[model samples]
Target chain A: MSQLTPVATTWVNGQVADNLPVTDRGLAYGDGLFETLRASHGSLPLLSLHLERLQRGCSALRIPFQGERIEAELNMAASVVGDGVVKLVLTRGSGQRGYAMPVDAVPTRILAISPLPVYPADRRDGIRLYSCATRLSDQPLLAGIKHLNRLDQVLARSEWQDPAFAEGLVCDQQGQVIECTMSNLFARVDGQWVTPDLGRCGVQGVMREYLLARLVERGEPAAVSRLGLGALHEADQVLCCNSLIGVWPVVRLGDRVWQVGDETRLLQSLAEQVYQ
Target chain B: MSQLTPVATTWVNGQVADNLPVTDRGLAYGDGLFETLRASHGSLPLLSLHLERLQRGCSALRIPFQGERIEAELNMAASVVGDGVVKLVLTRGSGQRGYAMPVDAVPTRILAISPLPVYPADRRDGIRLYSCATRLSDQPLLAGIKHLNRLDQVLARSEWQDPAFAEGLVCDQQGQVIECTMSNLFARVDGQWVTPDLGRCGVQGVMREYLLARLVERGEPAAVSRLGLGALHEADQVLCCNSLIGVWPVVRLGDRVWQVGDETRLLQSLAEQVYQ
Candidate 1:
């Protein structure tokens, strides 16, 4: 028999509850945005980065953002979570059965905490990536923001179930590599770090943003390039990152093989200094 | 100063409840499907067509299809609504915080009934269509099925607020006319019927399917063509159709104007016989 797992504790609109009204537009039409944060020692290290993305998403979608109230709730949840993951879902709330915005709409905020995921011990050193057949749709309007309409990512993630493949590598319709199912990708091509351009498709991760900023601060800025599979295969090193899993070096993808290079280690150490 | 409107009656998993567990994948990632049906005289006329599409969607998404149970629930909801609308939402249900499908996901079914929406009397004669700036993303994996990841439609619908424009015309990123915000489009160009090809994007509506079949039965099948705005401008007649709205002839789009043509009348009559 399987052991009982610790259930997630959730709050809806600052009230402790585990259910949402079925009419909430988040479920009705995926009219919402979400942020997944890592809580460390009762504090969120990159709270500002997450909020910036959330604020941008809300503004783009025309949803009212109550930042002060949301931050207060997030702080409370982070204190309870200590060293786990905190997810925030903001929806346009319930509306009449229509696509038009409700004039008097109140936004719904859901904050929850779940136990930290356990990964293979060696996964930190390197992981294999599965090439997903599900290509990312090129909609610049919805690109680079973490929104609730993520069925594309869901479908890509579903393509592989083997534990050996840590994540799936996704591409756009034009066969250009975009990002992984749940992380952003970076490649070291010809001694220069290059990450895929997310202007057309892909969710921009906070960790990727932080790393890019850090790289810039150190005077070794990474280029945002349009990378195809050929460029990825020819790269000296490959790495993937997100808020949850700071950085994981990709050692193998199909016939291509890579060693955890010095650049990868340096980025991992930088992430460790902050995440730890 | 405002009169109270009749609230929708909802049933979740066969129970009279209006809330769902917050962990549902549908709310988390929009991993679900939905159908909006028009009920008349205590019955759903287009039930079979809706289910056929739902079945195809569930199969494509790897979700379990509980056909009989859903049919029963739809019947119950239709009886209560009598002459209104019935909406069904089927989600992959609650899951752990990840994109990977839970091995044993119990699908969640939500059935609700609301009063019929009322439009202007002149809307039936013709309505203007706003050319939306929001372009549909091209993803064949999620195309042609009414999956719940509909943020594109939500954004397109939000573009215009003019009462004169009843719906918005959405095109794909390639500048091909796809569909309206909430309905499928058909145009008569050079004495031949043409509809936008949905192999790349746009939802394949049940009403669209019904009309296509009806046209085929009359030996005048609509061509599934890749129609650009140029072709649309040259069309003799343009029509939009959905389950609730039945059929509406487009009267105007910007500088271009159209009258209710004879072909549009034929399709309207076909929809009327069943919807009435």
Candidate 2:
């Protein structure tokens, strides 16, 4: 449903520069961080959360943090459309062909406004999953932070084109379930809502973190735990959550099918209150 | 040493273009392949080898191949610099913000030439190595080919900045020594040269492959074998090779030191024949 719309913006520090330079490290080495935010009725729900995560990611990557400029840019992006998705990309500016960071490099920022993708009405009606062959690397240093090195996700996502499969579950080299390609996986087991710990592999999704806090506030126990294939197979209820896609229940994983449980629906409703 | 001499000419779709759209998948997800070649007297010594490797990388990533245009672009790039280094970057062009490849994508091709980096004369005299804690993932699908998703190498390289430590050796999850950040490792053990197998991790450097073939032709037994830390420490001689560096002897890895031996010097002489 994405039609060509007149999306306009401005870039700083260059002439005729509404675009990033070809020599940007983001393009060269994928040296960048991005935040995809949804704005409804000219206001972003949990905007602070998105900005905090972005700032944290920038700090972790040693990218210069420009909070004031980013807030102004976000406002400008939202002004064009009353409601939509705004993507803010911050790159380590231009550099010569090498991995060493320039001593006096200025960071580049890009802001793009686009219509939020429309999801299927039954997207929450228990989706299907494929166990992706692509395994996430167990890199504690790069894990948890949302960096631009996403080849693993791209490869895993390319494995299937069938609309029937909503997402894919990826594990680490040790066969420990990490998370989905683009979302954080959560499962209800032994009367607790649990998600995989991203200390070893996977991104610490903003929505996943928010859900964990919400569950705690409501006196519902939730935890971040190490998970394995056996845990996934024995999970009473399964769901995937991302900032864009609030919560999606999984009805089947491979040949095993699951029913949409009460906890899954409860989490979906809670996220809808914030996302919708 | 990189002065603004405008060292190279780049052509896109048979026209001179320098800037790519920010939406390019290479910038978005690093969905691209690159080749760094050594050019001398307006000709690339292993041009066919580099092109074949690039084609193989494209085939592995499912990226479209445009060899004719790439050849023409390389010729133009070489014409600008009689002796230099030529870098050819092929990206999956612009796409919507997603991992899925655009159904009809015309890949972006970038060709640039620059002066060869000056290596220290004493670099031939064994260099120090650091065993980095950054472990490479055992992903065979993306292994061997030099793609843009190199955060692992970037992280490993950033671990040290000591001039004495010329290179860092990375290992896979199974504690198998893979390769250096930008080069391939070879060790002379039992009077035979052996390099780590790249079937699971590490990039297959063109120069390393060339040397392997040359060693085989000379009746000097060579092998692609799985290497361990113990084997590396007990090796008779250690060397690292790449297209740019040619061959560099390893004098020390942590506390263990290796003396420059005849086998390493012979390999260096063989590589220098082509490099110089």
Q: Which candidate should be chosen as best, given TM-score against the real structure?
A: 1
DockQ of 1: 0.80
- Docking quality band of candidate 2, CAPRI definitions: medium
Per-residue lDDT over A1-276 for candidate 1, one digit per residue giving the tens place of the 0 to 100 score = 011113448888877788999999999999999999999997999999999999989988899988888887787788888899999999999998888888888999988898789988898999999999999988899899899988888889999999999999999999999999999999999988999999988999999999999999999999997998999999999999998888999999998999999999999888877777
Task: Say which candidate scores most in lDDT.
Answer: 1
lDDT of each: 0.90, 0.81
Best by DockQ: 1
- What TM-score does prediction 2 earn? 0.93
Error of 1 at A189 (Å): 0.5
What 10-residue stretch in candidate 2 chain B is worst by lDDT? B1-10
Q: Candidate 2: give the TM-score of chain A.
A: 0.93
**What's model 1's overall lDDT?**
0.90
Q: Across all candidates, what is each one's fraction of true contacts kept?
A: 0.84, 0.54
Question: Candidate 1, residue A158: CA error in Å?
Answer: 0.9
